[model samples]
Target: MFTGLSAFPLIPTDENGIDEQAFVGLVARLAAAGVASIGALGSTGGYAYLSREQRALTAREAVAAAGTTPVIVGIGALRTRQVLDHAADAHEAGAAAVLLAPMSYQPLTDDEVFGLYRTVTAETTIPLVVYDNPGTTHVTFSDELHGRIAALPNIGSIKIPGVAAAAAPARIAALRAVIPAHVTIGVSGDWLAAGGLLGGADAWYSVLGGLFPEAALAITRATQASDSTAAREASNRLEPLWALFQRYGSLRVMSAAAETLGLVHSPNLPLPLLGLDPAGRSELEATLLRLGLGA
Candidate 1:
């Protein structure tokens, strides 16, 4: 809640449906490992792939498992009414917040994005966080647009991908100046988080933290304590994992890692986005060992 690590874990699923026990167990593990919050239905969580029933059940189990640790449900969709429906289910499931990313097959204008948030926030009393993942959604959020959304009644946080390594600190600083102090700035893309944290960003919207919450917490705590050397060291130790993320995608790598580590079984990922190939398997498993995840 106070500018810490928020995990977006791989949404564990089986052939039948959302693996309730496996999903809840992962949430409990992250909470035990000191994650400030857990998010379900994120890009990594495969939100768009799930049916409305699957999404509702996933949110319910996640919130129940998280207990005191807050759960943020991704309500991102191609349409306003559909996103509103997810928000209603998430709030009813006891989620602490909803993450909104305006994704569509057709390109969207700035005004349309703002209107989507405005309508969803007005409909749900639960706090909403702006999820700006341009890489996947192709819906970029300009600084002016971020400021406008920050003024929305229930909007509370913005999850942004970090800028280039050299310019990250400056970008975070500039964003801080534009958005109100109460609105939190969270950095996603695991590779970009260290610079953002060093630059005073409030939270890390982490993917690997989905598996290694304590390790992510270590990096954040060191930065907050003003120990840049230790923070960088901690972040550097996980560089091997980031390499895999860049090459074959975080969702693929995370699913493979989770299965190899026995955290969960091989998942039934939506088609055209299956597990890693043979070469990726060898590389990813080796990195997991290097990171001492006992793969």
Candidate 2:
């Protein structure tokens, strides 16, 4: 489907803050690069740092820039009401779907998590997608939960980060066994594109797609088309590029890579997260050069 070749975390950042114009350019670039969908205000987009208005504005900008492509707004928040509110805003702002995580207040009971998705699905007309990123949320929704949620008419997909890259294939296979055909399984790990495709993921969401949409899309399409050799070569070519961010962390180093490639003006990060250091910057640039990504 068109959804398989999209970029998440098409974030807006500059030396100052969210760069509206730059973000518009980013959307256009992703569309031209052949991305069929895009997501904003996701974890990597620093959604927590944006004010409510900024969040809505970002959604609007993304939708406006995306043209005919689908834009999914990240509606995840620490509160249920907030997620519902964001879902409303995103829907009004032209989002085709909303991606949300379970509330972060406490370790949720299975019933509570199930109820949460039920409530969200009930409250929104737009399609809702479950986000499963155990590294950040420390919660892994069971396949049982996915089965239940995926059965909901409004639930469209599950975004699962392949953080445990090695074990991802098994987990993905298990997830695929339960989820419905229309309810997609989205992988969110930078290095697990081919593996995820082979394991039955319908689509992928990761910063790897943001920095290298052309290459990531190529790899995903190849794998989906059963071209194992081409997919392997594509992944191999992107290994050093992924390593550049893997070595220093995706969020921080990706901003630097964006700046180095002239994709964005500066690596402006949120509070408590410092921008790249000189040595780190030098190393990232060198790695990007080696990957032939530093424009």
Off by over 4 Å in 2: 14-16, 163-169
Per-residue lDDT over 109-174 for candidate 2, one digit per residue giving the tens place of the 0 to 100 score: 878778878888998998877888887777778889889888877888888876354566788778
Return the lDDT, model 2, position 281: 90
- lDDT tens per residue, model 1, 121-173: 78889888899989899999999999988988988899998666578788888
Output the lDDT of residue 35, model 2.
79
